[model samples]
Target chain A: SAVISQKPSRDICQRGTSLTIQCQVDSQVTMMFWYRQQPGQSLTLIATANQGSEATYESGFVIDKFPISRPNLTFSTLTVSNMSPEDSSIYLCSVDNGAFFGQGTRLTVV
Target chain B: DQQVKQNSPSLSVQEGRISILNCDYTNSMFDYFLWYKKYPAEGPTFLISISSIKDKNEDGRFTVFLNKSAKHLSLHIVPSQPGDSAVYFCAAIGSNYKLTFGKGTLLTVNP
Candidate 1:
Protein backbone atom coordinates (compact mmCIF):
# COMPACT_ATOMS: atom_id res chain seq x y z
CA SER A 1 0.00 0.00 0.00
CA ALA A 2 1.60 3.23 -1.20
CA VAL A 3 0.61 6.67 -0.07
CA ILE A 4 0.13 9.01 -3.01
CA SER A 5 -0.43 12.71 -2.62
CA GLN A 6 -2.12 14.51 -5.49
CA LYS A 7 -2.52 18.28 -5.60
CA PRO A 8 -5.39 20.51 -6.65
CA SER A 9 -8.12 18.36 -5.17
CA ARG A 10 -10.69 20.36 -7.12
CA ASP A 11 -10.32 23.13 -9.64
CA ILE A 12 -12.41 25.16 -12.03
CA CYS A 13 -10.40 26.26 -15.03
CA GLN A 14 -11.27 28.30 -18.08
CA ARG A 15 -11.33 26.81 -21.52
CA GLY A 16 -8.15 26.99 -23.63
CA THR A 17 -6.06 27.08 -20.48
CA SER A 18 -3.92 24.32 -19.06
CA LEU A 19 -3.89 22.75 -15.61
CA THR A 20 -1.08 20.67 -14.15
CA ILE A 21 -1.79 17.96 -11.59
CA GLN A 22 1.01 16.67 -9.40
CA CYS A 23 1.42 13.20 -7.88
CA GLN A 24 3.89 12.33 -5.14
CA VAL A 25 4.47 8.92 -3.68
CA ASP A 26 5.86 8.16 -0.28
CA SER A 27 8.43 5.79 -1.75
CA GLN A 28 10.06 4.98 -5.04
CA VAL A 29 7.85 3.14 -7.52
CA THR A 30 8.92 1.63 -10.78
CA MET A 31 5.73 2.26 -12.71
CA MET A 32 3.42 5.26 -12.33
CA PHE A 33 0.34 6.01 -14.39
CA TRP A 34 -2.20 8.74 -14.97
CA TYR A 35 -5.91 8.14 -15.50
CA ARG A 36 -9.03 10.09 -16.37
CA GLN A 37 -12.61 9.39 -15.37
CA GLN A 38 -15.20 11.35 -17.20
CA PRO A 39 -18.70 11.80 -15.87
CA GLY A 40 -20.64 8.53 -15.97
CA GLN A 41 -17.67 6.72 -17.47
CA SER A 42 -14.87 4.43 -16.44
CA LEU A 43 -11.22 5.23 -15.76
CA THR A 44 -9.14 5.54 -18.87
CA LEU A 45 -5.37 5.38 -18.95
CA ILE A 46 -3.77 8.65 -19.95
CA ALA A 47 -0.13 7.59 -19.92
CA THR A 48 2.65 5.82 -18.09
CA ALA A 49 5.12 8.16 -16.42
CA ASN A 50 8.63 6.85 -16.84
CA GLN A 51 11.51 7.79 -14.65
CA GLY A 52 14.18 9.96 -16.30
CA SER A 53 12.43 9.61 -19.62
CA GLU A 54 9.39 10.65 -21.61
CA ALA A 55 5.93 9.49 -20.62
CA THR A 56 3.99 7.02 -22.69
CA TYR A 57 0.59 8.28 -23.85
CA GLU A 58 -2.33 6.05 -24.64
CA SER A 59 -4.41 6.08 -27.77
CA GLY A 60 -6.58 9.17 -28.37
CA PHE A 61 -4.22 11.09 -26.06
CA VAL A 62 -1.20 13.01 -27.28
CA ILE A 63 1.88 14.17 -25.45
CA ASP A 64 1.27 17.73 -26.56
CA LYS A 65 -2.24 17.65 -25.16
CA PHE A 66 -1.25 15.95 -21.93
CA PRO A 67 2.41 16.59 -21.42
CA ILE A 68 3.81 14.53 -18.59
CA SER A 69 6.97 15.02 -16.57
CA ARG A 70 8.56 12.34 -14.42
CA PRO A 71 11.66 13.92 -12.94
CA ASN A 72 12.23 11.14 -10.45
CA LEU A 73 10.74 7.94 -9.08
CA THR A 74 8.62 9.55 -6.38
CA PHE A 75 7.14 12.51 -8.26
CA SER A 76 5.34 13.22 -11.52
CA THR A 77 2.99 15.77 -13.04
CA LEU A 78 0.33 15.79 -15.74
CA THR A 79 -0.73 18.89 -17.62
CA VAL A 80 -4.00 18.98 -19.49
CA SER A 81 -3.37 21.36 -22.36
CA ASN A 82 -6.00 23.40 -24.20
CA MET A 83 -8.80 22.38 -21.97
CA SER A 84 -12.47 22.31 -22.91
CA PRO A 85 -15.77 21.31 -21.37
CA GLU A 86 -15.12 17.78 -22.54
CA ASP A 87 -12.00 17.71 -20.40
CA SER A 88 -14.04 18.02 -17.25
CA SER A 89 -13.21 14.90 -15.34
CA ILE A 90 -11.35 13.45 -12.38
CA TYR A 91 -7.69 13.01 -13.11
CA LEU A 92 -5.89 10.41 -11.04
CA CYS A 93 -2.32 9.28 -10.57
CA SER A 94 -1.51 5.71 -9.62
CA VAL A 95 1.51 3.75 -8.50
CA ASP A 96 1.59 0.16 -9.74
CA ASN A 97 2.42 -1.86 -6.66
CA GLY A 98 -0.54 -4.10 -7.35
CA ALA A 99 -2.07 -0.63 -8.04
CA PHE A 100 -2.64 2.21 -5.60
CA PHE A 101 -4.31 5.51 -6.53
CA GLY A 102 -3.94 9.06 -5.37
CA GLN A 103 -6.96 11.02 -4.16
CA GLY A 104 -7.31 12.48 -7.65
CA THR A 105 -7.74 15.98 -8.98
CA ARG A 106 -11.27 16.96 -9.96
CA LEU A 107 -10.98 19.35 -12.87
CA THR A 108 -13.84 21.21 -14.46
CA VAL A 109 -13.05 23.13 -17.63
CA VAL A 110 -15.70 25.77 -17.92
CA ASP B 1 -14.18 -2.38 -27.63
CA GLN B 2 -14.08 -2.16 -23.87
CA GLN B 3 -11.97 -4.91 -22.36
CA VAL B 4 -13.61 -4.85 -18.97
CA LYS B 5 -17.38 -4.51 -18.50
CA GLN B 6 -19.64 -3.93 -15.52
CA ASN B 7 -23.12 -3.84 -16.94
CA SER B 8 -25.07 -2.90 -13.83
CA PRO B 9 -25.09 0.82 -13.29
CA SER B 10 -26.26 0.64 -9.67
CA LEU B 11 -27.48 -1.81 -7.06
CA SER B 12 -29.57 -1.46 -3.92
CA VAL B 13 -29.19 -4.00 -1.15
CA GLN B 14 -30.55 -4.16 2.34
CA GLU B 15 -28.22 -4.11 5.27
CA GLY B 16 -27.10 -7.46 6.75
CA ARG B 17 -27.63 -9.08 3.34
CA ILE B 18 -25.21 -10.11 0.68
CA SER B 19 -24.02 -7.59 -1.88
CA ILE B 20 -22.80 -9.09 -5.10
CA LEU B 21 -20.99 -7.16 -7.82
CA ASN B 22 -20.20 -8.70 -11.19
CA CYS B 23 -17.45 -7.97 -13.72
CA ASP B 24 -16.45 -9.38 -17.10
CA TYR B 25 -13.38 -9.10 -19.23
CA THR B 26 -12.85 -9.88 -22.92
CA ASN B 27 -9.09 -10.07 -22.80
CA SER B 28 -7.59 -13.40 -21.90
CA MET B 29 -4.18 -11.92 -21.44
CA PHE B 30 -5.18 -10.37 -18.15
CA ASP B 31 -3.55 -12.44 -15.42
CA TYR B 32 -4.56 -10.32 -12.47
CA PHE B 33 -7.90 -8.79 -11.49
CA LEU B 34 -8.58 -6.18 -8.80
CA TRP B 35 -11.58 -4.53 -7.20
CA TYR B 36 -11.53 -0.93 -6.01
CA LYS B 37 -13.99 0.97 -3.85
CA LYS B 38 -14.58 4.67 -4.35
CA TYR B 39 -16.45 7.18 -2.21
CA PRO B 40 -17.44 10.60 -3.40
CA ALA B 41 -14.61 13.19 -3.26
CA GLU B 42 -12.07 10.40 -2.67
CA GLY B 43 -9.74 8.27 -4.66
CA PRO B 44 -10.56 4.68 -5.56
CA THR B 45 -9.16 2.46 -2.85
CA PHE B 46 -7.77 -1.01 -3.43
CA LEU B 47 -10.27 -3.47 -2.05
CA ILE B 48 -9.19 -6.93 -3.13
CA SER B 49 -7.39 -8.76 -5.89
CA ILE B 50 -7.15 -12.27 -7.37
CA SER B 51 -4.70 -13.96 -9.63
CA SER B 52 -5.90 -15.93 -12.64
CA ILE B 53 -4.44 -19.12 -11.21
CA LYS B 54 -6.98 -19.22 -8.42
CA ASP B 55 -10.74 -19.49 -8.64
CA LYS B 56 -11.57 -17.68 -5.46
CA ASN B 57 -9.91 -15.39 -2.93
CA GLU B 58 -11.39 -14.29 0.34
CA ASP B 59 -10.51 -11.43 2.63
CA GLY B 60 -12.58 -11.06 5.75
CA ARG B 61 -16.09 -10.02 4.66
CA PHE B 62 -15.21 -9.73 0.99
CA THR B 63 -14.66 -12.61 -1.43
CA VAL B 64 -13.78 -12.54 -5.09
CA PHE B 65 -14.67 -15.49 -7.32
CA LEU B 66 -13.12 -15.82 -10.71
CA ASN B 67 -14.33 -18.02 -13.56
CA LYS B 68 -11.82 -18.16 -16.33
CA SER B 69 -13.95 -20.19 -18.69
CA ALA B 70 -16.70 -17.60 -18.53
CA LYS B 71 -14.27 -14.70 -18.45
CA HIS B 72 -16.19 -13.31 -15.53
CA LEU B 73 -15.67 -12.52 -11.87
CA SER B 74 -17.83 -11.45 -8.98
CA LEU B 75 -17.33 -9.85 -5.56
CA HIS B 76 -19.47 -10.83 -2.64
CA ILE B 77 -19.72 -8.83 0.54
CA VAL B 78 -21.41 -10.47 3.45
CA PRO B 79 -23.48 -8.54 6.00
CA SER B 80 -23.61 -5.37 4.02
CA GLN B 81 -23.48 -2.19 6.02
CA PRO B 82 -24.29 1.45 5.36
CA GLY B 83 -20.57 2.14 5.13
CA ASP B 84 -20.45 -0.22 2.15
CA SER B 85 -22.39 2.23 0.03
CA ALA B 86 -19.99 3.39 -2.63
CA VAL B 87 -19.01 2.91 -6.27
CA TYR B 88 -16.96 -0.25 -6.97
CA PHE B 89 -14.69 -0.55 -9.94
CA CYS B 90 -13.25 -3.66 -11.59
CA ALA B 91 -9.78 -3.43 -13.04
CA ALA B 92 -7.53 -5.89 -14.88
CA ILE B 93 -3.80 -5.88 -15.49
CA GLY B 94 -1.98 -7.70 -18.24
CA SER B 95 1.70 -8.23 -19.05
CA ASN B 96 2.01 -4.68 -20.31
CA TYR B 97 1.49 -3.30 -16.79
CA LYS B 98 -1.40 -1.13 -17.90
CA LEU B 99 -4.64 -1.52 -16.03
CA THR B 100 -7.96 -1.40 -17.85
CA PHE B 101 -10.97 -0.52 -15.77
CA GLY B 102 -14.67 -1.13 -16.25
CA LYS B 103 -17.45 1.34 -15.71
CA GLY B 104 -18.12 1.26 -11.96
CA THR B 105 -21.27 0.06 -10.22
CA LEU B 106 -22.67 2.15 -7.40
CA LEU B 107 -23.83 0.13 -4.42
CA THR B 108 -26.39 1.58 -2.04
CA VAL B 109 -26.84 -0.35 1.19
CA ASN B 110 -30.12 0.65 2.73
CA PRO B 111 -30.40 0.59 6.48
Candidate 2:
Protein backbone atom coordinates (compact mmCIF):
# COMPACT_ATOMS: atom_id res chain seq x y z
CA SER A 1 0.00 0.00 0.00
CA ALA A 2 1.16 3.51 -0.71
CA VAL A 3 1.32 6.26 1.88
CA ILE A 4 -0.08 9.74 1.17
CA SER A 5 0.92 12.99 2.84
CA GLN A 6 -1.37 16.05 2.72
CA LYS A 7 -0.38 19.51 3.82
CA PRO A 8 -2.34 22.18 5.69
CA SER A 9 -4.12 19.52 7.73
CA ARG A 10 -6.48 22.21 8.91
CA ASP A 11 -7.01 25.84 8.00
CA ILE A 12 -9.33 28.77 8.66
CA CYS A 13 -9.79 31.29 5.91
CA GLN A 14 -11.94 34.31 5.27
CA ARG A 15 -14.64 34.33 2.64
CA GLY A 16 -13.53 35.00 -0.94
CA THR A 17 -10.00 33.89 -0.05
CA SER A 18 -8.32 30.91 -1.66
CA LEU A 19 -6.45 27.94 -0.25
CA THR A 20 -4.37 25.32 -1.97
CA ILE A 21 -4.07 21.81 -0.56
CA GLN A 22 -1.15 19.60 -1.48
CA CYS A 23 -0.98 15.82 -1.69
CA GLN A 24 2.21 13.80 -2.04
CA VAL A 25 2.23 10.07 -2.51
CA ASP A 26 5.10 7.85 -1.45
CA SER A 27 5.03 5.92 -4.72
CA GLN A 28 4.14 6.97 -8.23
CA VAL A 29 0.54 6.34 -9.15
CA THR A 30 -1.17 6.75 -12.48
CA MET A 31 -4.36 8.28 -11.14
CA MET A 32 -4.91 10.36 -8.04
CA PHE A 33 -8.41 11.11 -6.77
CA TRP A 34 -9.59 14.14 -4.89
CA TYR A 35 -12.71 14.04 -2.71
CA ARG A 36 -14.67 16.34 -0.45
CA GLN A 37 -16.56 15.41 2.72
CA GLN A 38 -18.95 17.99 3.98
CA PRO A 39 -20.25 18.04 7.55
CA GLY A 40 -22.10 14.82 8.22
CA GLN A 41 -21.97 13.90 4.55
CA SER A 42 -20.42 11.30 2.34
CA LEU A 43 -17.30 11.64 0.23
CA THR A 44 -17.93 13.32 -3.13
CA LEU A 45 -15.47 13.05 -5.99
CA ILE A 46 -14.03 16.38 -6.97
CA ALA A 47 -11.76 15.37 -9.81
CA THR A 48 -9.25 12.86 -11.09
CA ALA A 49 -5.75 14.20 -11.49
CA ASN A 50 -3.61 12.59 -14.13
CA GLN A 51 -0.08 13.52 -14.99
CA GLY A 52 0.49 15.69 -18.11
CA SER A 53 -3.16 16.41 -18.78
CA GLU A 54 -6.11 18.43 -17.67
CA ALA A 55 -7.94 16.90 -14.74
CA THR A 56 -11.40 15.38 -15.18
CA TYR A 57 -13.90 16.99 -12.86
CA GLU A 58 -17.11 15.57 -11.53
CA SER A 59 -20.54 16.85 -12.50
CA GLY A 60 -20.92 19.35 -9.72
CA PHE A 61 -17.29 20.43 -9.72
CA VAL A 62 -15.72 22.87 -12.13
CA ILE A 63 -12.11 23.53 -13.06
CA ASP A 64 -12.40 27.21 -12.31
CA LYS A 65 -13.68 26.80 -8.74
CA PHE A 66 -11.58 23.80 -7.85
CA PRO A 67 -8.57 23.75 -10.10
CA ILE A 68 -6.36 20.67 -9.94
CA SER A 69 -2.78 20.11 -11.00
CA ARG A 70 -0.84 16.90 -11.30
CA PRO A 71 2.69 17.96 -12.06
CA ASN A 72 3.95 14.40 -11.69
CA LEU A 73 2.91 10.97 -10.61
CA THR A 74 3.74 11.47 -6.95
CA PHE A 75 2.46 15.00 -6.53
CA SER A 76 -0.84 16.90 -7.01
CA THR A 77 -2.46 20.07 -5.78
CA LEU A 78 -6.11 21.25 -5.37
CA THR A 79 -6.88 24.90 -5.14
CA VAL A 80 -10.16 26.22 -3.75
CA SER A 81 -10.70 29.61 -5.36
CA ASN A 82 -13.09 32.25 -4.06
CA MET A 83 -14.12 29.98 -1.22
CA SER A 84 -17.27 30.57 0.73
CA PRO A 85 -18.75 29.18 3.92
CA GLU A 86 -20.14 26.20 2.08
CA ASP A 87 -16.66 25.30 0.96
CA SER A 88 -15.68 24.35 4.48
CA SER A 89 -15.06 20.65 4.49
CA ILE A 90 -12.43 17.96 4.52
CA TYR A 91 -10.48 17.49 1.33
CA LEU A 92 -8.68 14.22 0.75
CA CYS A 93 -6.42 12.70 -1.88
CA SER A 94 -6.34 9.00 -2.59
CA VAL A 95 -4.66 6.35 -4.72
CA ASP A 96 -6.31 3.14 -5.87
CA ASN A 97 -3.62 0.88 -4.35
CA GLY A 98 -5.91 -0.56 -1.68
CA ALA A 99 -7.46 2.93 -1.93
CA PHE A 100 -5.10 4.65 0.48
CA PHE A 101 -6.06 8.19 1.54
CA GLY A 102 -4.20 11.10 3.02
CA GLN A 103 -4.89 12.38 6.53
CA GLY A 104 -7.00 15.11 4.84
CA THR A 105 -7.11 18.88 4.95
CA ARG A 106 -9.96 20.32 6.99
CA LEU A 107 -10.82 23.76 5.64
CA THR A 108 -13.11 26.22 7.36
CA VAL A 109 -14.24 29.36 5.58
CA VAL A 110 -15.54 32.08 7.81
CA ASP B 1 -29.11 11.94 -6.80
CA GLN B 2 -26.71 9.71 -4.92
CA GLN B 3 -25.53 6.70 -6.87
CA VAL B 4 -24.81 4.76 -3.67
CA LYS B 5 -26.85 4.84 -0.52
CA GLN B 6 -26.45 3.59 3.04
CA ASN B 7 -29.80 4.05 4.74
CA SER B 8 -28.67 3.42 8.27
CA PRO B 9 -26.80 6.24 9.87
CA SER B 10 -25.50 4.15 12.77
CA LEU B 11 -25.38 0.60 14.03
CA SER B 12 -24.60 -0.96 17.40
CA VAL B 13 -23.26 -4.44 17.99
CA GLN B 14 -22.08 -6.45 20.94
CA GLU B 15 -18.54 -7.73 21.09
CA GLY B 16 -18.12 -11.29 19.85
CA ARG B 17 -21.19 -10.89 17.69
CA ILE B 18 -21.73 -10.37 13.98
CA SER B 19 -22.02 -6.90 12.53
CA ILE B 20 -23.76 -6.43 9.21
CA LEU B 21 -23.57 -3.18 7.24
CA ASN B 22 -25.62 -2.76 4.10
CA CYS B 23 -25.31 -0.64 0.97
CA ASP B 24 -27.36 -0.12 -2.17
CA TYR B 25 -26.50 1.38 -5.51
CA THR B 26 -28.59 2.75 -8.33
CA ASN B 27 -25.96 2.62 -11.02
CA SER B 28 -25.82 -0.50 -13.13
CA MET B 29 -22.47 0.27 -14.66
CA PHE B 30 -20.56 -0.25 -11.42
CA ASP B 31 -18.43 -3.36 -11.61
CA TYR B 32 -16.47 -3.13 -8.38
CA PHE B 33 -17.41 -2.37 -4.80
CA LEU B 34 -15.27 -1.55 -1.75
CA TRP B 35 -15.57 -0.96 1.96
CA TYR B 36 -13.62 1.62 3.91
CA LYS B 37 -13.24 2.49 7.58
CA LYS B 38 -12.66 6.00 8.85
CA TYR B 39 -11.82 7.44 12.22
CA PRO B 40 -12.25 11.04 13.30
CA ALA B 41 -9.91 13.60 11.83
CA GLU B 42 -8.44 11.02 9.46
CA GLY B 43 -8.98 9.77 5.96
CA PRO B 44 -10.73 6.48 5.21
CA THR B 45 -8.80 3.20 4.98
CA PHE B 46 -9.75 0.35 2.73
CA LEU B 47 -11.29 -2.62 4.52
CA ILE B 48 -12.17 -5.04 1.78
CA SER B 49 -13.32 -5.22 -1.82
CA ILE B 50 -15.53 -7.44 -3.97
CA SER B 51 -15.80 -7.55 -7.71
CA SER B 52 -19.11 -7.97 -9.49
CA ILE B 53 -18.11 -11.38 -10.76
CA LYS B 54 -18.21 -13.02 -7.31
CA ASP B 55 -21.13 -13.17 -4.92
CA LYS B 56 -19.02 -13.33 -1.82
CA ASN B 57 -15.43 -12.65 -0.73
CA GLU B 58 -14.01 -13.25 2.69
CA ASP B 59 -10.79 -12.33 4.47
CA GLY B 60 -10.09 -13.12 8.07
CA ARG B 61 -13.16 -12.03 10.06
CA PHE B 62 -14.43 -9.72 7.36
CA THR B 63 -16.76 -10.83 4.61
CA VAL B 64 -18.42 -8.96 1.76
CA PHE B 65 -21.50 -10.21 -0.07
CA LEU B 66 -22.75 -8.76 -3.30
CA ASN B 67 -26.09 -9.19 -5.05
CA LYS B 68 -26.02 -8.14 -8.65
CA SER B 69 -29.71 -8.44 -9.27
CA ALA B 70 -30.66 -6.48 -6.20
CA LYS B 71 -27.86 -3.98 -6.69
CA HIS B 72 -26.97 -4.36 -3.06
CA LEU B 73 -23.82 -5.24 -1.10
CA SER B 74 -23.11 -5.93 2.51
CA LEU B 75 -20.10 -6.23 4.80
CA HIS B 76 -20.20 -8.64 7.69
CA ILE B 77 -17.70 -8.62 10.53
CA VAL B 78 -17.80 -11.62 12.83
CA PRO B 79 -16.88 -11.48 16.49
CA SER B 80 -16.83 -7.74 16.36
CA GLN B 81 -14.31 -5.91 18.49
CA PRO B 82 -14.15 -2.52 20.13
CA GLY B 83 -11.50 -1.44 17.69
CA ASP B 84 -14.01 -2.01 14.92
CA SER B 85 -16.00 1.02 15.97
CA ALA B 86 -15.75 3.51 13.16
CA VAL B 87 -17.59 5.00 10.21
CA TYR B 88 -17.87 2.46 7.41
CA PHE B 89 -18.31 3.66 3.86
CA CYS B 90 -19.29 1.71 0.76
CA ALA B 91 -18.12 2.73 -2.69
CA ALA B 92 -18.88 1.70 -6.26
CA ILE B 93 -16.22 2.10 -8.90
CA GLY B 94 -17.27 3.72 -12.15
CA SER B 95 -15.48 4.78 -15.32
CA ASN B 96 -11.98 6.26 -15.21
CA TYR B 97 -11.49 5.17 -11.61
CA LYS B 98 -14.32 7.36 -10.40
CA LEU B 99 -15.85 6.16 -7.16
CA THR B 100 -19.31 6.95 -5.91
CA PHE B 101 -19.60 6.67 -2.15
CA GLY B 102 -22.53 6.14 0.16
CA LYS B 103 -23.28 8.03 3.29
CA GLY B 104 -21.28 6.07 5.88
CA THR B 105 -22.75 4.06 8.72
CA LEU B 106 -21.08 4.51 12.06
CA LEU B 107 -20.62 1.14 13.73
CA THR B 108 -20.24 0.93 17.48
CA VAL B 109 -19.09 -2.33 19.04
CA ASN B 110 -19.63 -2.55 22.76
CA PRO B 111 -17.79 -4.91 25.03
Tens-digit per-residue lDDT, A1-72, candidate 2: 899999989999999999999999999999999999999888998998899999989888999999999999
Q: Evaluate fnat for each of the predicted models and list the values in order.
A: 0.68, 0.79
lDDT of each: 0.94, 0.94
Pairs that collide in candidate 1 are none
Q: For each candidate, report its DockQ versus the true two-chain complex.
A: 0.69, 0.69
lDDT of 1 by residue, B35-92 (tens): 9999998889999999999999999999999999999999999989999999999999
Predicted candidate 2 versus true structure: per-residue lDDT over B23-109, tens digit per residue: 999999999999999998889999999999999999999999999999999999998999999999999996655788998999999
Among all candidates shown, the one with the greatest TM-score: 1
